[model samples]
Target: MKELFPLKQVMGFAFSIFFTLLALAVYFFNMSFTIGMTVLLVTAFLQAGLQLVVFMHAGETEDKGAIYTNIYYALVIALVTVFGTLLCMIWGYV
Candidate 1:
């Protein structure tokens, strides 16, 4: 019954837990702001990608190309919006 055990999902879940704990370590260890933020961002992106591919099955469809394209577009838009706001409000570069 190995084929019916959902191994991939289990592994993904375990990896998600590991990443979560790693992020938490940054907080508990009292890392510098830059280091903590870097670690958190890296773990967050990795977990998000893992969830998308493993849990959400982003690559298991016939239209996977379209799905990934949409994801890329959304990422670009989000980055632009965030950086634009930072540039105007925080960086004083309006």
Candidate 2:
């Protein structure tokens, strides 16, 4: 029975639940825009990282370093794409 339970996965599940609840609270409560956005952003990033490391087992394999590097590259590209779009379309970069 003990061997059946994956402790790390359980912990990850709990943490994911916690982050979800926190996000819900931010949505339900009448928080200031800046505060709400900040909290939501922080929780969102944490949840994503937790999901990757725990559920996805991102660091368990022998090629973990390469995997992490690829993830980082993807993240950088995503950020750049988002910000560039915003700058050009929303912020009026010409």
Q: Quick one: best lDDT, which candidate?
A: 1
Model 1: per-residue lDDT, tens digit, 21-75? 9999997999999999999999999999999999999999999999999999999
Which segments of candidate 2 are over 4 A away from where they belong?
Answer: 1-4
RMSD (CA, Å), each prediction: 0.7, 1.4
- lDDT for position 90 in model 1: 98
TM-score of every candidate relative to the true structure: 0.97, 0.90
lDDT per model vs. reference: 0.97, 0.95
- Model 2 Cα lDDT, one tens digit per residue, 1-94: 9999899999999999999999889878978999999989999999999999999999999999999999999999999999999999999997
| Candidate 2: residue 85 Cα off by (Å) | 0.9
Worst 10 contiguous positions by lDDT, candidate 2: 23-32
Q: Which stretches of candidate 1 lie over 4 Å from their true place?
A: none
What shift in Å separates residue 80 of candidate 1 from its native position after superposition?
0.6
